[model samples]
Target: MSDTHLLICGNSFNDVDRDRLSTAYPAVYVDAPADMAALESGLRASMRAVAFKGHTPFGAEAMDLFPQLGLIANYGVGYDAIDVGAASARGIAVTNTPDVLSDDVADLAVALMITQARTMIRGHAHVASGRWATEGEIPLNRKVSGSTVGIVGLGRIGREIADRLAAFKMDIHYTSRSEKETPGWTYHNDVVSLAGAVDFLVVALVGGPDTKGQVSREAIAALGPRGVVVNISRGSTIDEGALLDALEAGNIAGAALDVFENEPNPDPRFLKLSNVVLQPHQGSGTVETRTAMAELQLANVAAFLEGRDLLTQVN
Candidate 1:
């Protein structure tokens, strides 16, 4: 057996991938864990860098169990669920597939804008529930063209969204950590002011402790009654309760969400509202994107085994 033992705390590994792992390391796969305790037990017994599927979190305590863990190759781009600082403290490198998912996520963001703006959900519910005739012609939803679009956290995905929206003749404005010098776009130093400035506030920021509650109640309120909020980023970036309250009060026009704080199990309260559009974190769920993500993850693992630097190290 190879000295580099590998363990995966996630869904079924690709059969080909599993067979490949068997060639080099003692690969283990666990599914539908009852609790973290079971996962902890598995990690403690393993002496290798562990891979996690979905949103399995590897915090300080979890990291402590694997002394020989050289790296954590997370399955997704966002490391919100993982404790990067904790992993670094233990001299473990954390890698995420970032650029691979940016365009996919940006596509979802624009799709959200189109879906919510066109009231696609309202029309769909009408037809599905057999109430289309009774509803008597679905009302017109908001328009996307030539609208002021404000992007929060103007990173790779945000920039992509901006580029796509420009084709619609929409005015672009953004708020980031610092002012970016992109030509033909307005930059706002204050997110609250930026929220108030645009017809649609599109969120494409990363989610983690730092970005937790970044979109505050005050910011949401600033968006005004006619403003639409679109979140293609992590849900933790927005205050869920505050968002619900804004939707209830009609403070903001509507929202299109592709991700949530409690994913796979989003707040049930959001489902009750017709003004909100929800997607099950499928921003990067495309076959092409997912395959790319897995390939990158495998490359990261292979590089580590060869004593090479990670392709997309989070640190």
Candidate 2:
């Protein structure tokens, strides 16, 4: 067998696979804690292939440094951080774990929507801070049941969220470039109109230059005072400053966010707001989901070695 080369940028697989990769391929394991800078030297040494996770960016500039790279498979559904366009231009195949994390991320989106709608965080804090009874009855919140729900993107996770909300009898509407006939749900051609019409707005759009800051101030303003916003997609999809302005000015009721613009470091203003809920971009964090993702990455690597097209091609 001809020697195949691979580089692992994150620690997802077990120790056995790490050892196996070294012997089977022209492999390199990046063990450093620092960002992509720390991995530059190791990635430069290998010419045949590479696999990475976390903040090891492979943009146009980064990809230019490695001419021999045949494939790049990410460990998560969203490959926003990676420059897929650049890789495509270079004739490299890029893949991500899509179906594996759809359900998990959908679940988180639904939960965050309910949390914000019901004011669950404020309720928990009231009791924990020992002011439950003395607070003169906590504020009332809009019920999630029977609300008009709008989704920004109607892709995998967006469709899943629509399916789950059916049990609540929610009036569901979604936005996409094209129209799709989803049972019991309506599709909106205009995202701003969808935002205006729905009582709850959930963001499920992908992140890239095309979708970056797509949810503008006008969209948020259209949602108005009684509506609540939930984002389970990339943070760049929404204008963070616009969202904060809406929440602070009571233009919208509240927000629940699972992703941030510059991940690992959300705006500090988000932490100080009582009308919003935040998570550290953990849409697909379940053990089962993560294992499935790792397995897909393995399959992608195996396919690349055998001169086969990627099973889950991105582009």
Candidate 3:
């Protein structure tokens, strides 16, 4: 059998990173979980690590294929797709690329907020369709600056978003597991109260079961008709049904979403809404940030293989 010890799974990994991993280790590449069975025949028993990058579920059933596997280094900060509990039970380790992508994700969140508030998409369409020649101007839109904004989950990315918004002189509010030491920002114990207190709500929470549906129907209602929602975090963080119903009924003014519950192909209902701006989960897709994430992922894998401490261990 070959001495391949690293199995790089998922199609999301760029060619540059794939080549780098191949050069650095005895690696085998497979596109996704469905293709794993076919590749299993050739994989060496020495496989000890997986450089995972896709959204497919990697549970105990999948892990059972490789008896020697010890580490799963994830390319993205969010590892919801991987069952860390199962990894732990098997005496395996898990690592993710965190702080490296925080700035980029936060920048996208702020951009989404501004885009939705100013109706930037519609304005571009109006100009492109030559309506600007016929109509005097696009209808006046909501201003983002000087607005009251609430940030949910003030971790690394959340703090970055809040800091950027502060430059616009907006009032910032946040909810976290514990209160922070920011005297200028308001703190809310719950998401519902945070929603009620702000003109815009930006979600920057982590993904996983703990955060699932944290933004409830009541929180959506609290935002009222004039409020806008911006989410750069995981889609499961919000109640999708409530958000869809609210958008349809104009309960909130609009939403700008980077992630979705069912991504790449989100619910068809979202595509029909004119008040919404949808993105295909590209918050950290910039060339610089993606390269950094890939480097960090590889660094963690190398650390585990070389008997060194992991750069960003989650489990």
Candidate 4:
């Protein structure tokens, strides 16, 4: 029997990525955190590292199951699903694949902003469904170029998004822990002010307790019915209830979301709206970025197993 030192948790891994990890280490695979408890005592004891890849909560209880777990190598940039405090308390290191996916996520955010602003989906449908030929012409939508955009977080991904929009001649405004050194870009101390100042608000804040609902009802209201929101970050960073309310009542212009509070099955109310642009959480879904993420995750797993320094250790 192969050694079970590495356990691959979560069902989101593609076949190639799974094969790469399993080939690199003696591994066991489980679909979710709950399945870890079903393994035999000896096997659980053998798990030294976990390559986690899903949004499922891997908390203290789940960590306790693997008594020998030394590392939790999360697959994506956001390690919000894993309980870092619990892992730290248990002497387990945590690593995440961050910068590799930043460009892809940033690209998606920009694409979403442009798509919603210009109504690309509707335009495509108009041509594909023969509506343009029959009805004469589709309505002209808003232009993205030369518009004002506010980025909620000036992190790696956030900066990338701002840089892309800046190329389009946009006036960039951002809010972060502290002001960055970028010249000409306005810095807001609060999200409400940021939303009020820009035509498009992009959320790139990290997901965690500190940031949950950081974009509140007041912030959404401050957008003043002319602003659009583009979120490529985790669903927890924004107040989904407030965003939905704004969309439904036309309090804000619309939203282009790559993440949601309840994913795979978002709120049914979103289905009824035509202004919103919804995505299936595919921020880093490109083949190149995902392959890079998997490689980073595997590198972290190997580093932990071989007693080397972790590449992107968070805790």
On TM-score, the candidate that comes out on top is: 4
User: Which is the winner by TM-score between candidate 3 and candidate 4?
Assistant: 4
Best by lDDT: 4
Q: Clash pairs of candidate 1? A: none
> Comparing candidate 1 with candidate 4, which one achieves the higher lDDT?
4
How do the residues 8-83 of candidate 4 rate in per-residue lDDT, one tens digit apiece? 9999888999999999988999999989899888889888999999988999999999888899999999999999
Model 3: per-residue Cα lDDT over 198-299, one tens digit each: 999999899999999999999999999998889999999999999999999999999999999998889999999999888989999999999999899889
TM-scores, each model vs. reference: 0.90, 0.89, 0.97, 0.98
Candidate 4 is scored at a TM of 0.98
Clashing residue pairs in all predictions, respectively, total: 0, 0, 0, 0
Alpha-carbon runs more than 4 Å astray in model 4: none
Ranking by TM-score: 4, 3, 1, 2
Query: lDDT (0-100) at residue 7 of candidate 4?
Result: 91
- RMSD, every candidate, angstroms: 2.8, 3.2, 1.3, 1.0
lDDT-based ranking: 4, 3, 1, 2
lDDT of 1 by residue, 206-280 (tens): 888898888889999999999888998888899889998999889888999988888789888888888888898
In model 3, the runs with Cα more than 4 Å from the true position are: 40-44
Flag clash pairs in model 2: none
Question: Better model by lDDT, 2 or 4?
Answer: 4
